[model samples]
Target: MTFWFHMNGVGIGSLKVYTNDQSGSRKLAWQRVGRQGPDWNQGHVRIDTDVQQVIFMATTRFHYGSDLAIDDIVMDPNPLVLTTVSQTYPSTASQTYPSTSPPRRYLTCDFEINLCGWEQDGELQWELKRGASPDRTSGIVDDHTLLGGRQYAFFNGHKAVNSSYVARLDSGQVFFQPGVNISFWYHMNGAGIGSLKLLQRTPYGNVLSLWSRTGRQSPEWLKAEVNLPPGLYNLTFEVSAQHHFSSDIGLDDIVLSEETIS
Candidate 1:
């Protein structure tokens, strides 16, 4: 059995699931406590014995302590099975399996905890901030990753001097095949906003511009997607800011995945 749940608010509380047998014996199957942020979390449980009843409970300390939400409950009779093969091979022989491993996402970052292996390079640095920018004259009030409950990478234009200031967030080297897609959410709002550029740095010390946006955009978060040719390269998000407090910019939820086609 599997289900998706979300929890928010102040106080202390828990979301619990129980299974009761025909003999009136009840056992706790799954449980979660505290806040799980603004995004939905997945929970799974396996029951070998017959379940006569299933119970879902949400407990809170006070009226405004916490809130629990559950959705998309799924019950699967056939659980996952693991198989092992035993083989005796000669010393001179070898075995190999082609395309047997499971598919995986290349890179995913929300900046919820930290930079997720990204590095900062330049005169100015990008800050890991929550809620809103320090100046508060521009930028988003909440992060784009989880709306009201997450942190994002932000660049403050107020720190710029008489000359244009440049800040960069660089990703580690990633192998890109055909149909690889990169997507991210950004918030560019302010009076003196400058240009935001996405550059691909190749292994041979070559830099290629992929995508870019200039000037002030909407106050809300906007999404951007880019598709690159097959190669090995590092991704750099470079932002050039003018000298103004209102030229703040934000970035969140960067994902790199393979696009499936029919």
Candidate 2:
């Protein structure tokens, strides 16, 4: 059995699953007795013998504000095989179910032909340009998509009247499952570089700041990744300039895919 669960404010409470048969009852799974955030997490359990019933229960010592939720429970007759994948960042090891599961790519954009589905949301817009930015001192010298051949999105800091001037690129509503991977290449070069923020706006009008980077980075493009939770949300890439021509920022090769499990 496989399912998705979210736990919140469970200070001393525990969530458990059990399988019962003619032989007896056995605990199948249980969550740590602590507070887990709103992030959706995957759970799996295997039953070897014939089971008459499956049960999910929550027990708590303090019942004031504890919350435990579960969803997307799937029971397959076929046996499931688990595999381990080595990861350098985020964690040292990760688990993947069903070794044949392949990552599903949801979106991929190079900004070579157009902005794809991305839209300009603020007054200071993201411009599609090739090679260096207008000022040539800040921003990327070549697009990360094709080195010197293709185009990329650039925010011209030269036009900013003040340091508060922001350029926003928004990806309209998209559906994402739990544990999706969002990645992109960004260039923040120049003496006057400012800040870049990645935000997630939910359907209920709640906005969450996922990631942010301030100040100037390396002259070459750098990669960034965000592990997004399950939801239908809009993604916003916001850049604020330092009111200098060299404060420009560049973004390229945006991609979103299911978390790779190998």
Candidate 3:
């Protein structure tokens, strides 16, 4: 049990003290916290132990791999020692992020990729299929290439499609609006990287994304959103093939909503 006065960060200023103790050295005694570690070596305290010593120990979690260095220890006397100088410093939490913001949205574009025919492409193409849906109900044609059908990455009268672009929906969807929330669910097998968006065609490039990270990935639901500006937008589930010849991705059920964001 000892006392110490921290001398770090106090700019050069006169410290006034009026002590009645006759023996100054016997007034108080202290053992430094961490005499090792980078900060401690730089005249800083890493830990103030329960029972301190010149050779103090510290437990830490490192984010990087590195060899422990010996010269990281430092020792110096308190420049502001007095009759009794102690400090009850910070312990755990430093700061916290705000928790009241809107939550993120994750949309999953489940493939009617089966709409094509075989399990060949894993339904990963943006192209349309024969007897697809709605439209002429005739030949297989990409809805994005059709008139007003561009709303779909692929769509028709039978089955609807959500695109990587602005579009509409049949049932569950973010329902593009100026003040709506959007998101997507995703499971990619190749590259983990691709741009997902809730984009406006007016500005033509307005966007949103669930993940920007790249690597191989498993299929899963991932959401993203955008606050539109008086035009149409869709919670588009866009993905790029991982050029590694590892095949394509498989997606599950996709859902978009106008629900409150987190």
Question: How does each model score on TM-score?
Answer: 0.57, 0.57, 0.29
TM-score of 2: 0.57
Task: Compute the lDDT for candidate 1.
Answer: 0.71
Total clashing pairs in model 1: 0
10 residues in a row with least lDDT, candidate 3 = 114-123
Candidate 3 residue lDDT tens string, 56-91:
222223323322222334343321111112344489
lDDT of 3 at 189: 36
Per-residue C-alpha lDDT of model 2 across residues 135-186, encoded as one tens digit per residue: 6655577887554778888888888888888877766555555556678999
133 Cα displacement, candidate 3 (Å): 23
> Model 1, 1-262: lDDT tens per residue?
6678788677648787889988889987556556656677666555544688889999886678477789999887653321222354788455432221111121367887655545556667787788877656676798975558689988887788843578877654555556656788999988788889999987577999999999889888999988766666677899987656678889988876655323
For all candidates in order, the CA lDDT equals 0.71, 0.69, 0.28
